[model samples]
Target: MTKESDDNGNTPITGDEKTSVPADLLNIEKGDVVDISSDDALLMALGYKPELKREFSYLTVFGQSFGAMGIAPALAESLIFSLGSAGSVGLVWSYFLGCVALIPVALSLGELGSSMPTAGGLYYWVARLTPTRARALMCWLAGYMNVLGYISIFASTIYGATLILVAAIMIGSDGTWQTTKYINYGLYSATTILCFGMTCVPSGTLSKLNNTYIWFQLAMALAVIIALPAATPKEYINSASFVFKEFQNTGFWPNNGWAFMLSLLTPVWVVSGFESSATIAEEASNAARAVPFAMVSSLLIALVVGMGVVISIAFTMGSDVIAIVTSPLGQPMAQICLNSLGEKGAIAMLVFLWFTSICNCSMLLVAASRETFALARDGGLPFSSFFRVLTTNKTPARAVLFCALVTLAEGLLMLVNTIAINSIFNLAIMGLYFAYTMPLVSRLIFNEFKPGVWYLGPKLSYIFAVYSVVWMTFIFTLLLFPSYPNPDETQMNYAVAVLGFVLVFCLVYYYFPKYGGKTFFHGPVRTIDEVIATNLQLEEQLVRKMTEDRAASAT
Candidate 1:
């Protein structure tokens, strides 16, 4: 267990010499007694001490991202956006192309995640990948964008859950009961609180629940895919031509081409939270390997399964896209389900979808809170110390509460105007992709890019990184456009304005005054010294134990 000191009176560890220490008189000798895991060592090297419990194995980590995507329910939540834009053909083809185009983005994320897996996600990557002179400013920009996106995701998903709940209630009531925005806001608030509570459980417990829920997601998706075709009357089912070739545009966009492109938002929204796997890297075992593998694999699975769900719906969702959108039930998917499955069956399906929607909110909340905690840990946010505090069970309770409060406040926008709330929700998708763009751009411009265990190597990595940046920029531009060419208040898209406000806030906050990020923040702070100190203490304790053992044996 002991290593012989070199002539310089220092003993080196097996992995990194930086972890070596002096081997003098009063010191401990045993290295085997303190077996540091690779995960812990790597985390230390990344300037952290593994504060979060590494409870999520590869499967559970994969489940985290997969469950966050909430493929079946998320598709249902955004189906109207696609179905209304280009009918069944747009619904199917747009999803397929959008998913195909995003593969490079996902691959680029996997590369960065593998190289530098941390809960800080994109911002940490930005800090490390950029030059020292620009590190703090770029880090601030990336961190705020990432955390804001996370909060927006939690709010939007909870809102989607609210919609599902209201739809379920109306269907259960046989469409006699009506709902308003006030009712919707109340349900959304309750669901947000409920998800925050769910996310406050011990990390181990939540990981287990996520593991179980991933299968539930698959089962529910398969059930709908199968049951939709089985339950739909032959008269209601559309033919292959109608499913694949029909183009219906209700928006005021210039042409059917633009309408089809607009449909891309649905898949983009559905796949919004797949990066959640990276946001939990600190809590995942073998994170560098697990995070990348989980992220790309989950998206790949979503691509196929999501296609199945959409195509199934396109065939069985009936011919009237406008009717589905304008249905009295207040949800497009609910109306489609009611048409295909009837009242009782639709209620059952909606209830299950509602439950999964809640789980999706919780899953997204976990990522959001972890992201907030990471940024706060780096002294990036106001009251950083407070939000960085973890609960007794090693969960980010304060960050969870902070995110929940933000979600509740953002939900108030629904009361002001529906379009305003929609802008905030759309901001989630735009802001997240904006965050995603920085690290890829950094890797491309900086020469310090390093590959980890799951890398795509030199040429392929550059290829993916290049494509990802180009594609994300194009998509972000597309996202800023309003659904219609000419629009009134309700039809106007304000997401661009929202994004501009967020950017201004970040710029102002970073350089405001003595409390600015420039004053205290210096990228991610290193805790490696603490780790080394703890190891030295443990080694000294072992030395004392050995001395006592020898004395006792001699006596």
Candidate 2:
């Protein structure tokens, strides 16, 4: 484990603080006992009660995460934004490269989530992983970053989905339809309302919804993978030479290498949000095993499928890269589909993208609301009681509707200048990853990782955790770099400014008298005796089940 030293050169965290298990409790090694108390005991040890229903199985949780990333839909819509700096080789390679770099980051999250299954996720992990003196302050910052990140993710997704649908509308109109600013706003309103209503439904039905979307995503991606290439005309099909050797820098940037490097954001942005399962860990049964498995497996699935679709697009995107990106239809993917496939086939593809986007939007709303509800439950946000309230079926109904509405409201930025919308989307990658890297670094510093159902040995785990910090540092810098060089005021990247305001706002809010001054604002609260008692009851029930099983076998 890595260590930090003070000016005197002695380690700050002494021997007692090294182990995370409570000192008062017996030191029961994880996985050595059949106790029903592992997850709950860990939570109680960290001062939280297990209130969420543990109904989600491993596959169901994986389905939720797979739908959340919306990998195919995300790439289809965002590729146009990177066209100036990317060609066929650059486009497809960047995605797989980013996925490779992100594996360690995701695995780090898997390790942390397996050890601590909490709804607050990264922020909660930070609280438990850091030393006591710095715990509250660091946890507070991590929570704020996570909350703001998802809100931006929600807006960015809805906006992208809206554009895909709007492009379809224009296609069907045969040049008569125009996507006005208000039209974009209308689509955003409709999507927000639809997703909000769905998320507020009973928690049981939410699982069913995830199941449905998971299949839809697979079918749509498969259709595109086979159909698009088969339908492409011989003349329009790209050759191996063009696919692997071609290069384009039509955006007029100063450096082609840097421009290509920064264009990787398109893939990084699309492949992200795999951490959704970790955020929803509180709802999953045996989360220590399930959450990490769901996170790692979902990304692996997306990588294979997403790469296939990207390669297919690279092979069949047509000979005219310039025309496809600059299409008058106001949607690049829609135009590419039209040029590759005929009108009927193109319409069919757009319809597929539209529904997939809806599925993606729904998943994002579910995750964002749950995160918001968890934060509010811990008194991290305003009106904590209101946002934390669950419905008859244990769903965060109010938080779901409230956060969805706010994200839609932020979509009003589309009217000001469509280009600026990049800043909002960039916040999702920057905020979530920055938040993600913090806890991993903190864990290494404090030596806080404990063996769980899913264990990685210390040497290998520390290597990934430390590497993730370095990778995120580079990504953090690259995300803020201007997408278009020599930009006018309207074209400038505003993510740095907007993210700065958020950081300052978090600081101001933390220091405010009524908010952080209260008992709720303290890092994680201490577990009450009630939590331990409840675990004892649960343990008794497990014993009863085991006894019944043995008796039946004997009979």
Candidate 3:
């Protein structure tokens, strides 16, 4: 049990689990001991010291993930577009069945969560799993791709909620109060401000609110499921409609693989970022176990509860669903509620949806801020120190506010080209899932990874990993094609250009060194070894001091 000092007369870390320290803070001599027992030590093991507080519990962690899913609001907003593309029955069945494709992704991602739970999530894994020579480039690409995805989801979510809120106000005024897109933008900015407020709170407070959030989501969904059906006139409600009736597509897309695939986006979007749990792993008290389960269970909750809610809305939406989808109110869910529940009921329901959407926006901001903070800590972004700064409350205040500002900027773009904005939002899918696939691909190809406390068995894990890669590749190719086809009305697949911009920007950033990303960009700094070294030196110093005292006493 004797300890030896390193060449610098400091502790030499023993054992295979040891890691090197970050360059900035390696000034330690013999007997210089540092606490390496807490979660901050875990960050040190990954080459970063503890910056943000770790106070999130299992429920708060789960609420954060589930809130990101925001099942009911997502279903409410996307239904009109999905139905327009594939009709009522088309979206219902496609989404239900599309769960098959997503199951493999969720499982595979959860497996990764068990292995490398980091705030950087996939990109951090990319740096760890990829070959030493290529790790920096790939990590850079993954980081940019993933952040853009988070940013897009943030903006799109708040914007959709804003539309619903506006529609509800108009409906309450009996369709007399008209508003402009500027009003919508203003609401979007205001919600972003609220989201920023939530992000500024200390860890435990958000966890408590998120605990309320997940339950509220479930209660509201169940309320709608049972109340809507019970109150609707039996003559107006039809089981056959939900199960089999297909509404006219009105030529949004020709009935083909493309149309069905496009409709699949509705459900896929609902399930897209289940990986949010992984991104916030640093805050979770027991990340390895909690992140994996949270990622999978949130989606399962969404599928079981969200699907039922969607089917209920469809059945009670009345015979003229096309009219509902194409309503002047700009919210199909609001119109559908008006049909089933009277005016008072519709307004009340819409208000609840708006409230939940605000919570959803805040949760999304939390995820994005964590990811931004992680990337900056690794010196991946310009002004890393600024984004990486933690407030007195131990929250990433600057990072979260930066995300809100970016969301506002994106909303401003909507004023320029309303139709192409779909591309910007769709990046949430294209960017994140693509970033996700990279590490799994490297692990599969390289066949090297250290298992965590939680992991799938060897054989099944590889199969699912390979499946994730193939599935993401397919989705990417499909995104290249236009959603509604035909070169008219500027409804182009602007996602292609957005993706191109991401690629180009990351490429440019990778080569430019003044940004300081060029040097020391390798992933997973040898954090464990540094602590072990310090401890070893401390033990040696203690031994030497005891021997000196004994010699003097003997004399």
Q: Name the top lDDT candidate.
A: 1
Instruction: Tell me the tens digit of each residue's lDDT in model 3 across 1-555.
Output: 253445766343322222333333433345554433234444554555455556677777788778887888877877765676666676677678766677778888887776777888888888878888888888988888888888888888888788889989998899999978777778878888888887788887878887888887887788789878987876558567454665555336677556667766677777665779887787787677788888788878778887788788767877666787788888888888887888898899988988887888788888888888878777777787798787777788888877887888778856756556556656778888788888888899887777765567888888888888998888777667776667665778777877898798778777767653556576555444554455765334334443333343346
lDDT of 1 by residue, 39-118 (tens): 65556667775678788889989998999999999988888778878889888998888888888788889988988888
lDDT of each: 0.82, 0.76, 0.74
TM-score of each: 0.91, 0.88, 0.87
- What tens-digit string does per-residue lDDT give for candidate 2 at 165-219? 8888888888797878888888888988887887787756788888888999898
- Model 2 alpha-carbon drift over 4 Å, by segment: 1-42, 514-520, 526-555
> Residue 100 of candidate 2: its Cα lDDT?
84
Could you report the Cα RMSD, in angstroms, for every candidate shown?
6.6, 8.6, 7.2
TM-score winner: 1
